[model samples]
Every structure is written in structure tokens, then in C-alpha cells.
Target chain A: MTNTEFIKSLSEKTGMTAEQLEPMVAQFIGAFARELASGRVVSVQGFGNFESREKAERKMYNPTTKSYKIIPKKVTLNFKMSATLKDKINS
Target chain B: MSDKVTLQSVAESFSRACGVPKKVAEQLARAFFDTVVDGLSNDESVKIDGLGTFRVVEVASRESINVTNGERIVIAGYKKVNFIPEDGLLVSNLVSDMPDVREDVVADDEETDVSNDTDETDIEETSEVDDETEDVSEDITTSEDEEPIDAVEAEVNMVEVPEKVEVQEDEFSGIDMLICTPESVEEIRLELEQARADAERKLIAAKEAHREVLRLEALLDKMEKSMVPECAEEEQTPETEAEPVPAMVAESVAKENLTIYEDIPSVAKEESAVETADEGQKAEEVAQTPVEPVEESLETVETPSVVETAEDENVTVNLEATTEEPSSEQEESTDVAPAEEDTKSAAEEAVQSTDAEVKQEDVTAEGAEENKDAQAEALNRLLSDKSAATPEPVRKKKDDGHYWIWILTPILVILIFGVSVVMYKAHSDKEKTELKQLPVEPKNHATPVKKQAPVVKPKVETDSIQSNTNVPAETTATEPAKSKAADNKSTAKPKTYILQRDETLTKVSRKFYGTKDSVRAIIRANKFKDPDNVPYGTEVILP
Candidate 1:
């Protein structure tokens, strides 16, 4: 299911308008983006952990060109399911 | 995990934004769904830029089954919405707390050491693999010591030696050579083990075959050892048996010769003079002599069947021989001529003896001769018709006795008497025929001659007996019955005729009767000894 589909499904379930639910979801997305960009963690309880990291410049292959290209050293987002969450998923 | 954000949960969160009632909010959500579906159907991209892009992607047509109707339907290439998450949203950290493993390679020409950072688990695995390989190599070396791998090792080297291996395929198999390296040490060990097993099996079979060969040789040796003594005994027995058989045959031949000599002394004497009769004489002398037990032992040595045939044939033949005539007559006739005086004396003696007991002895003698002739005929039938198997002259003497002497005695008597009667009738006829031919009348002498006939018969028989033994050259060359018949013919006549030169008895008779029809009668009337031999002017009787 997509984000809009998910939101629309929630609207049908609750007695709320799509406009009010839309702002709350946007605010949370914006906060998560800002904190991760500043090299901070957005730790959500009872869900999963997400973090940003940097990778060393390394050689990678572009399968379309079948040639080696340099993937530049850049920041990347990393998420790890917490032990409790991992246990819950496994269970 | 939190409650699943279904359409109901999301709509509750969205209801306050649209300021609509729950039912109106549900309608608005359905509208947004329709808008997304419509946009995708038009092949539009609904991009929520920071979150992700939802693009209408065309899926190529493929065959699929409609489960409800079980009908095959082709899902034509149609647009469907697909979402691609933003790069920032994709998690990059899957493994947590991974220690920094990179080594600093700041300067060139520096020895880099990352051993400290190497995984201990990987180290344990390498050591374990090395240990297993060492044990396996030890196993392979043991197998190599056990089996000579020359045949297969060359093939293995052939597979591995070439860097660019060119495989040679055999028509019989797809696998050329299984090249085992340190990487495949276990397989090499297993193959060596199999080879060792095959070698051991062959060795065992060869050993078994060798044992079988040894066993067969031993059996052959045993058989040869057993046969040696039996072969020696068999060889010796043939020699012993061969020696005795000839000795027995020689003894039988000598004994048989002795019997032959005893039967005829004249042959014994002549055989001595003419050939090797010394042996015959010795044999006869042996049988006749009472000095030695050689004859007795010979009798003992001869089988009972041989003795029976010899004694039976010998005694019966001699008894049937008409011993009235002495054996000297046979000997003298067969070989040397005895003196006339001796023959005359022998004949006189035989006649006197026959006359004294002729009637009784003749019957017995003829009866015995008949019996012997019957016996001889039986013997002839018993023998397959070989002239050699025929009994000797001594035996045949008995046969002539049956045909001529024994059978013809009574017949001759009856014939003589019947002739007298016929002669009486013939004389009557001759009177008429004679009267017709008679130039002179016949004197009546018939009754007077008839009165003299009985007396004349014996005297005539006596005369012939005397003449029979009275052979001018050899007195013993006599046929008794034949001579008697001739004498009877001569005695039956009254008149005589003189034969001219070269005349037969038939011619002599013809001179008296005018026709030769009376030739036989005339011949019968006179005892012209040989009818063909009427010597010139010889006296012939006319009946």
C-alpha cells in the first residue's frame, strides 16, 4: 500500500478529515529529516531505530555500462530494528 | 509492534484535516484512491518528492488463469502503480556495532598487516581444514604404500599436468580422468582406497587359483603313485597268461595226433616213413605203452567232452568196421601190398568165421553200422560244412558200410531170390524167344539147374570172396560186398560164351541171344568183374 492509500484508509476508519491528518504526518516527516541530516538519531519507541552514516569511497560496478565507477564518499541512512522489536518480529 | 495502520486507522488520523464526519472522511479517502488509480491508468507519476515516487509501470502481457472460471486469460500489458522509496529512506545499517576493520595504508612501500583484525572464526576454520587435510594426506600416503598406483597415477598426471587441459573422451565413458588435487584430497583418498580394495581382491583370487593348481598336482601325483604297482602287475600277468596258453594248445595238438595214430597204425607207420611220423609213433607208443603215466595224465589233462567224442567215435567206428576182415587188409590196400599167402589165409579165416555165424553176426554188424552211420550223419549236420571238420578215413569206412554193406545185404539177398523167380519166368519166355531163334531144340536142363542153385550160391560166394582178396597186385585191395555180388552173377548161369578181341560182356551176350536186349541180364548172369572189361576170349556166362 502507498502513503496516500494508507492515509485514505485511515480517514475512512476514523471520524477525521484528510487535511488535518495530512499536517500531522508532514510535521513528523520533516522533524525526522532534520534530525537525521544533523547527524542525530530519530529514535522511535516500539518500532525501529534509524541513523545516518558515511561510507568510504569505493569502486562499484554500473551493470548497465558493465564498467567500474567511483561511488563517492557520502552520507547514508541506516536503520536497525531494536532487540525488542527484532524479538517481536521473530516471535 | 503497534496496531496495523489499516484504512480505518489512517482515516482517523486524516479526519481532522478534512473537517468532515467519519462517513464523509471515508468518502474522501475513496476519492483519493480513485484519483491515484486514475492517474496510474493514464501512465502518470504521482511523486511525493521527499518520501518516494509512485509511477505508472507497464507490466507486459502474460498468461494467467482466472481461478473462478478456470479459464486462461492474457493480462495485456497495462499500467500499474509502483513506488520507489527515496534514497534517504532506505536503511544502510543492517549490521550493528561492526568494529572498524580497515587498516591504514598511508604510505607506499609499507608492509600492511591486517592479521590482528582477521576473524578468529575464519582462523579456526582454516586450522581445522588443515588438520583434516593432514589426516587425509596421511590416509592417502598409507594407501599409496599399500597399492601400486602406476596405472592410474599416469592418467591422473595426464589430467592435471596441462595448464590448458585438453580432455580426451573415450567412447566407453564420459568421465576421462578424475584429477584429485589438494582441494579434492578426500576424493583422492577414497579413490585410492577403492583401488587398494580391487588389488586385494585380485591378490586373493590369484592365491586361490595357485592353491587349486597345487591341489590338482597333488591329486595327479597320488594317482600316478597308485597306478605304478598295478601297471607292473598287469604287465607281468599278460606274460604269465601268454606262456600257459601256447603250452596248453601244443599239448592238445599232440594229444589229438596221438588219437589219430591209434586209429590207423598203417598211417602211423607211413607217416613215420614219409614225414614227421616219429612224433605220431611216439604218441601212439605212449598211449599203448603201460610203462609211463603220460597216457594217464594225458587222459586226465584232456577235457571230459573231448574224451567222450574221441572214445565214442573211436569205439563205435571200429565196432562197425566188420572186423571179420582183418585191419591188415585196409592197411595193405591203403599202403603196401601184403603177401598173397597171408591174404589168402586171412580171407579163409574171415570166410570161415562169417560162415559159422553169418546170420546172427551179420544182423548185429549191420545194425551197428546203421547206428554209426546215423551218428556220423548227425555229426555231419553238427559241423558247419568244412571238409576239414569231416572225420578221417577211419570214420568214412563206417559210412560205406551203411550204404553198401549193411543196407545192401538183405536187399542183395532179396534181389538174388527175386532174380531166380524172374529168371524162371524169363526162361519160359526165353524158351519161346529161343525157340523162335533156335536152329536146334533146347535140352530140358532148367529143373536140374534149379535143384543145384541153393548149393551153387554159397560156393559162388566162396569163390568171389577168395577172388576179392586175390588181387594179383595187392591182395588187400578188396571190396567185400562188391566182389560177392559179382560172384553171385557168375554162379547164376548155366552156359558160357567166349568173347572175341575187344568185346564187351554185352557183345558176348549178344552172340548168344541174337539181340543186345539181354545184355544186362547176361551181364548179371556172369560175374564178368568189370562189365566193360571182357578181355578177348574171356568166359562169360549165359543165363
Candidate 2:
């Protein structure tokens, strides 16, 4: 669903207006990114976790070039869905 | 701690997590499970957004064997609920920090976020101490709001009930750390202490192993150093005395080594061996012979050696000749068998008495070197006794000749035992000095030229004995009359001697003169009274 449509549906279901949910959703997304960038794992209950993890630098072989190249290390963001969330979607 | 997670427990946990009464949560949980079952039964897929998906897929009709009954059955087609987790949710729930596909996806998401907008970044690190402590006491199977710690925003979403513990029927992961109980804190402290102690013990063991290795290396080095010196000594021997040794010289060296190693008093053992051999020979030689003839033969054996010894005028040679003659007589007697053993016994007694005399002389020779004068005197007295007897001392000389042969073995044993090497060494040195006097072509040998010095003595003695044997053989070559005449001629001059107990006139005659004819003469004088029997202690006058 589009953001607006989902907001209206959630407002109807919980007896809350789109205005309240809109800010809450914004805050949720913003806080998740902030926590993740800060290296804190943002574990959304029954949904998924957002986190940044270290990716170690290593040598990668290129078959076409017939040589090795260093793949630079980096901090990457991760999203892991909670088991409850996964089970709910399939059910 | 409970083995399984059930729906009721999850519902209770959910109820507590959401601040709802447990009955409402239980009813809701039942309805949710009922709806999922119904959807799967209708061949539809059900999705619970925050949880997971459950889909029913067709089960094809097939034959299967029943294990219980060994029967095959074709069951009708059916649908099975196939749940495929979305976004790898199942991977996130396992207990340890086992980075599954969930972590990989999270890492990807992290990268994507940073790439999109990198401003809201942090460098926060989780405390390893908290990680270690929480790892213990995690098996209680309770669900608290684990999302509250890391993300402040996530905590607002979880409505938690205080003073209520929901022992949930679901697995959770590292994100959860309970509000620390005093008991759990104590357990954590103990576990940390144990881990630290283990690390320290391992460090000590490693250090000890290193020290032991070093000690072993030092011991190996010392052994190698010690072995090197032995090799050097072996190497030095070739450089110092590089010459081939003669067999005789080698034998001499071995004898020296034997003397050093055995350290037994070899002379006594040698003497006993020689005496036993001589006794065996004499027992037969004097067989059926009266005592007088034996004394005659024994004297003859001693006479030649005494003359040879006196002619040399050497005390040492006198001793050796005296020692040698008894063995020669023993050797001669070894040839005769005791046809009449009574005379043989009497002969043995005479031989033993002579042996005692020889042994006394040997003892004198063995006395101190300063007592050589006494030894020479004793030997001279023995010599005088042989010459003074009017008749030939052929029998005594025979005994002495027997002794010479017997004495050789013990001499060789002692020479090869000790003195042989010393004599051989001296001979070798003399040969080296008189190289021109030596035969030049014997260079392959290490023997000395003057090796002939001691070697000639045996040949000389053997020649004398051979000539002596030749004289007897020549005399016996004639008819029996000439041999008897020769015997009479040899026994013509004799001295008077007393007869002992068991002395027949024949025995007395042989003891005094080495003849049996005197028995006839003595009986004629006694007028044939007890003709065969002559009583003991008779002073028989020699005819």
C-alpha cells in the first residue's frame, strides 16, 4: 500500500487519525536509521532489526583478469526480520 | 528450561507484553490459530505481518509403504501447510551470536542506510562484559522486551508489564538482557572468575612446556659434545701409530690384556693342570716296572736337563730345565700300561716322592729373587744325587723327561699369560736393531729377526729327546740278548739301599738299580726260604 493509504487504514483500525500515525511513522523510520548509523541495533519487535556491521577487507580473485584485488573493508547496514513477523506473513 | 514452546505460553507473554488481561490474549491467540488453520484447509495462504507466513501447497497422490505393517497404500491427494519465512526471521531467533543470513541482510540494510544518508551515524560499541554475563542464565525461556535496550525508540512501542514474568514459549537471541536479579548477578560473577582462572592456568602450562623443551635441548648438546671427544680420540690413533701388527705380536698384546682383565693368580691353576697331566702319564709308564728302573729312567730324564742347565750356568735355565724334565718322564710313562698293577702302584709312590722333590725345588725357585742362591744350591744337590748313584739314573731321568713334556703346557700358559709377551717384545726390539742380520724379505710380517731365540729351545730339547729315543730304538733293533746285555751294562754299578714294607727283592733291586735279576740272587742267598716273600725293612745287600 502507498504511505497515505496505509496510514488511513491504520487510523481506522486503531481509532487514531492519519495525523498521529504520520508523525509516529516518520519518527520510527528516522529513529531506526539513527540507531543503526550509531551502531546500535534497532530491533523492532515482531518486525525486523536494523544494524550496521563490520565487513572485513579481503582479497578477491577475478577470473577474467587473472589477478587478485583487495576488496576494501566497510561498515554495512543490516536488516533482519524477526521470526514472529516472518511467521505472521506466511500464515 | 521447558523443552517445548506452546501457543498458550506465547499468548500469556503477549498479553503481559501488551498490558492486556491474559484471558483476552488467550482468546485472541486461539482465534488467530483458528484463522490460520482455516485458511490452510481452504487451500489459501495466511500471512501474519510481524510473525511469518504459512501456505498450503498440494500433496501429490503417491504410493508409500507403511513401516509398521509392510503394506503399500495409495492415499488421496491433500494439501500441506508450507511456511517460508520472509526476510530470514527464523535466523534471528537462535540463542548465540551465530551470524546467519539474518545478520547478512542486516549488514546489507546497514550499508544501504549509510549510503543513502550518512549524517545520523554513531560509533556505539556493546560491552563484551554484558555479553559474557548474559550468555549464562538465558535458558529460563522467558520473553521480556529485549528491543528496549539498543534502540530507545523501539522501547516506546513495547507496552511492558512490571512485576510480571512471562515464561514465553518462543526462542529469543542476544538482544535480550533481563533486569539483573541478584542471584543471576552472582552467577555471572562466578562464571567470569572461572574463565579468568582457566586462562591463567593455560598460560602457566605453556610456560612450563617451553622450559622443558629448553632443558632437553641443553642435554642433547652435552651428549653431542661428549661424543665428539671419543671420535677425536679414534681419529688420533691412526695419525700416531699407523703400522700393521704381526699375529704373534697381536697375540702378545691380547695376553697382556688378559693379565690386566682376569687378575687371577694364574700360576697355581697352571701348575695343577700340568701335574694332573703328568700323573696320568706316569701311572701308565711305570706299569709292571719295579721301583728301581723307574728311578733309573727318572734320573736319565733329569741328567740331560741338569747338564744343559749347568752348562748354561744360568739360574733361570736351571729352574726351567728342572721344571721341564719331570713332565718329560711323565710323557714317557704315559706309553706303558699297568699289566701288573701292584708294581705300578709301587712305581707311582716312587714317582710321587720324586714329584715332591721337584715341587720343593720349584718352591725354592718361586721364593724371592734374593733366594736364587738357595734355589741353585737345591738344584745342585739334586744333580749331585743323580751322579753319586753308581748305577745309571735312567729311570729318574725318564721321569724328568716326562716332566719336561708336561711342564711345557704350563710354561706356554704362563708365557702366553704374561712373560711370553715381555719376551716377545724384547725379541722384536732386538730384531729391529739387527735388521741387517735378519732375512730381508719378511717385511709382510711384524715378527722380529731374533724370534728364533726362545723358539730354538723347544727344537733343541726335542732333538735331544729324539736322539735319546733313536738310541733306544737302535738298541731294541738288535735281538733280545743284546737289549738285556745293554740293560745289565747300564745297571752294573749301584748303591745299597734299605727295602721298605711290601718290598720284594725284585722291587728292591729295581728301586736301587732298575733290575729284576737281583730277585734270583737274593733268593739264592736266603736259601729259598719264603722265596717270593721278603719281609718289610730288610737291609738287602746289592750283588
What docking class should model 2 receive?
A: incorrect
Chain A only: give the TM-score of model 1. Answer: 0.68
Per-residue C-alpha lDDT of model 1 across residues B1-543, encoded as one tens digit per residue: 122233433344344433445665445445444444444444565554344555655567899999999999997664444555466442211112111111111110021112111222333343343344321122222222222223223323332333112112111111111121232244345545544554444344334334433443443344335434533442232211111222222223432322332333333323223222332244345333331222222222121112233333433343344244333323322221112222222323323323422332223223223323333232221111111111222122122222234345666899999999999999999898977766333323333223333457766465544443342223232233333434454542236555656666654443334356778887787755777766676666667
Off by over 4 Å in 2: A1-91, B66-71, B98-543
Error of 1 at A65 (Å): 11
DockQ of 1: 0.01
TM-score (chain B) of candidate 1: 0.16
Interface RMSD of each: 18.0, 11.6
Error of 2 at B512 (Å): 94
Candidate 2 chain B, poorest ten consecutive residues by summed lDDT: B136-145
Candidate 1 chain B — worst ten consecutive residues by lDDT sum?
A: B100-109
How much is the lDDT of residue B203 in candidate 1?
45
**Per-residue accuracy of model 2 over B35-132 as CA lDDT, tens digit each:** 45445555566664423466666668889888899999887665455544344242222212233433543453344334223211211111222233
lDDT of 2 at A56: 88
> In model 1, where do residues sit more than 4 Å from their true spots?
A9-15, A60-69, A87-91, B1-49, B52-85, B88-543
